[model samples]
Target: MELRSSLGSVATLALVAVIVAMLVGQQLGQPILLGFVVTGSMSPTLEPGDGFVAVPPVLADDIEEGDVVTFDARELQGGGLTTHRVVGETDEGYVTRGDANPFTDQDGDEPPVQESQIVSVALQFDGELVVIPSIGTVALALQGAFGAVIGVLSGLPGGDAVADGNVETLMVGGGVLLLLYSFAADLLGSDRGGRDRSRSRKGATRAGLVLAVILLLILVPATASMVIPSGVNEITVVSSESPSSNPTTIERGGSQTVTYNISNSGVFPQVAIIEPASTGVEVAETTHWIWRGQSAGTTATIHAPDETGVYYRSISERQYLGLLPLSVIVALHAVHPVVAIAAIDLVIAVVVTVVFALAVGFQPLRFRDTGRDTSVVDTVRRTVRKWL
Candidate 1:
């Protein structure tokens, strides 16, 4: 029972902290993701119960050999948090090993994970491990109870898959319940007592400001920098054939016919137009095409030159037909990482700021007077604070 109360206290504290952090993220104009570790691979570095901060997967491959990282380690037999050192890379794939392990991991019989397998990398500071050893096990037990609730809801007489927005609704409702607990903590667990109410309020205010700064600068920026770009990433179009064309010594207006297939696998509505990038290359007049919109799948003709020995724009690959639209043929376009992430982060920051302002404006009143409480309040307050 003491453990349960402690767990509840920890959870309530973490929740309020996270929400406050998220609010700070919006003020600084960034995305915020509060993530917890579920694995013990990092051990003393990050106990299983502790929460770690993560920046998205953008420059994760850029993570150096010794950096601690959190990535989509699902293919390594199980999924969830994995903190490991990037050991080496062969033509096949990267090799990774945990910090405390005696030996490097043998590839788990699965194919060498491609670069896309990574999710995000977490950078933890010196000492934030607050969850007791394997405290998450108890948290998971609570989560398991919640899972049972979901299963019960799902199989009820006229129920649907807990997917009909009940999950989020329940979460918010649960948060509302927790919010009362948080206020109760503030009212009762004042490290500084009634004798020093002014000091407690002052400390709380300062702590709030510091938490705001950390959320805005570090946490929000990192999460926004990752998630917002993901939408844009989904809208890429690659030529089925390698988008690369060799430098050609060719004459103007001389036709060099190259055969290529244009695949628009992205969600955006775009049609491939074979435009001439060089003075020597010409757009083939025969190559006019209309894709039936983004999802209908359209194939376009790209011409390569024959003279001054024309370079044909032929990019074809039958081998990558399985992925549907995202082919091995990559187009060359230069966008700096800083500029790209900044653009999306700016947009997300705007949305987050608006919502957060509303939440602040409508911040709920913490408590209300129930008319019949004065006599009981002093007695219980004295009892609770142990002030005889």
Candidate 2:
């Protein structure tokens, strides 16, 4: 019985972790470890609503032709993450095509896939994709249910404001409420009369689990804030003798200044750093501090080569929460963007850990044995009735 209980606990924790990863991935607009298809793009290989393991670019081997990858598409189906197979490579980028498509993505309005644009490579064995059937179907069902709940909640007073808030914020709030309800149900419905001290210790374990969930609730979005807004920005430069008024069009051996806007729509202030990611791109002011609901502009000079037709230059932007000193953040960013993100996340994690320890301590929460014999459902129903 104890062995079975332990296995159940492990399974529950694993499931929770997967769910949290999916939620975080959705908010970040990138798959963390898992991804699914909503359309029959890959068809026989990956049917609609099938899920697959997504290996992050950092962990995956070098991308090559025939490898299925999930990349940020700029023009395909109005721009989002698209999973397809790399069919060819070019000096510019990779040529990708869906398994069911007749032509390559580059044959259409979609540009060649850049390395920076690829988020994850689908895991495969012997060239066959490892798929989790119907997982996306389950995810879609849960999303529909959540939307229905949100619709009902929107009908309540002051709930319209909450419904209009950020989706990630809503997810965190819903998670907290669910955790609280589960804790309450366990406390109210457990049979306490004949329970031994060992059984009471289980409540402490449950409390720790709740704490972990709360920690994830706070950290996932924090990490996403630092990661999601940071990526490569591409600039196309047309070089010719007859230079146009456009900033991107310049005479050979000349340069033009292009202004880029950095905006922060979130509640937290962000520190943004822009750096040249490709040749012939130079940022005038590399760092900008954007407060909540504000925008900042930075200028970059695109230099055309002595003998040029058309060229592409990239500028990389990295953002972090305004939680640490600017100097420290800048120094960490100089090392690497990931290093800066890790440092910021580490600082936030340490602060949150210390706060939680100060408030809750290392001990498990103790629950009194009130000898309640009610079922969890009954208890929840009664509580809801009382509140209503």
Candidate 3:
């Protein structure tokens, strides 16, 4: 009972968090929502698979130079949505650049970014932008699964002739019939088992309530996503030239400085990193890039490898998903790193429902070592109790 209740409580709390976050992030219907990094353009800072929350800018003019901001690409004849840093401010607009690039967006023959083109500013913590690393890969994987599922369905019995509409109708009808049978059986058997019947009905009522809440919460977002297909944008990444270590040759065990220029061209701010590819090399002073509208230089002191031959250093991007998911893996493991990427936010609520069942006082957790009582009524009680 305790475990079951904990599961239900977790689900309810998770659902509330998502709903509230969506509501707050999408304020004014600007479509500024949570998203993950899909490209390595922000490499060394925000690498592929990172996730971050994006909130719409309230005042475009308030957008300062050096702020990492997301904007429409059309303004520069670019692709879909692009996040880059504001490099310079002009009477015309904002000049942007990618940290990995050798030149600014304007140098590529594009005009300065205007305020109207701005979308959301990446969320920040302690004056530094935070991103959840490697979560976006899950969404990418789900897209792959969706295609595979379609292929499997198409190959079934009737092949292309197997209509999904027909299958759905049949499934719905079968569910309704099964539910009716269960209710009838419970009612008919009640006279012979009064206590059992009462317990069963109570369980059924709680189950029904939980199901209803879930459906109600889901219906809104599912409908919204369907209604606004354009609101969904693919991940975009931009990259620029990063610095390499100097004095290519160094005596074994000798020390040297590796300097690199890190820039943010996308609106999202990234934490620029300089890490050695091998344990033989050690670096110092790895700092977070503010990505404040311009390119900044980062330097790290490192000890050369004792072994001879070429070695490499990586400039990487990291994401901050906040403490809950980062500190505790299972807390946000719903966005599985390996599969089911498509489930994203929706599946999280479903996953947390182990707590939901217990939270609403529907089914109390059972931990007693008492003899087992695994009757069908107890199994089906949550739904039946409400109607009874």
Best by TM-score: 2
- lDDT by residue (1-388, candidate 1, tens digit) is 4477568778877775555443333232232353345666656666676554545554434654555554445456455335565677654345777656665554553333334444445554442322234534544555555556656766887546453564353554355445566468656555434455453332222333333443476445354333332321110112222233432322333323433344444333222323332222233431222233322222333333332221223221111111112211112112333343354445445655566556553332222344432332343455458754
Per-residue alpha-carbon lDDT of model 3 for 280-340, expressed as tens digits? 3344544444344656565655454555544433333222211122223222333332122
Which candidate tops lDDT?
Answer: 2
Q: Rank the candidates by lDDT, best first.
A: 2, 3, 1
Report the C-alpha lDDT of model 2 over 152-173, residue by residue, as the tens digit. 7778887777577666455754
* Clash tally, candidates in order: 21, 0, 53
The Cα local distance difference test for each model comes to: 0.42, 0.79, 0.49
* Candidate 1 worst ten-residue window by lDDT: 315-324
By summed lDDT, which 10 consecutive residues of candidate 2 come out lowest?
196-205
Ranking of all predicted structures according to TM-score, beginning with the best and ending with the worst: 2, 1, 3
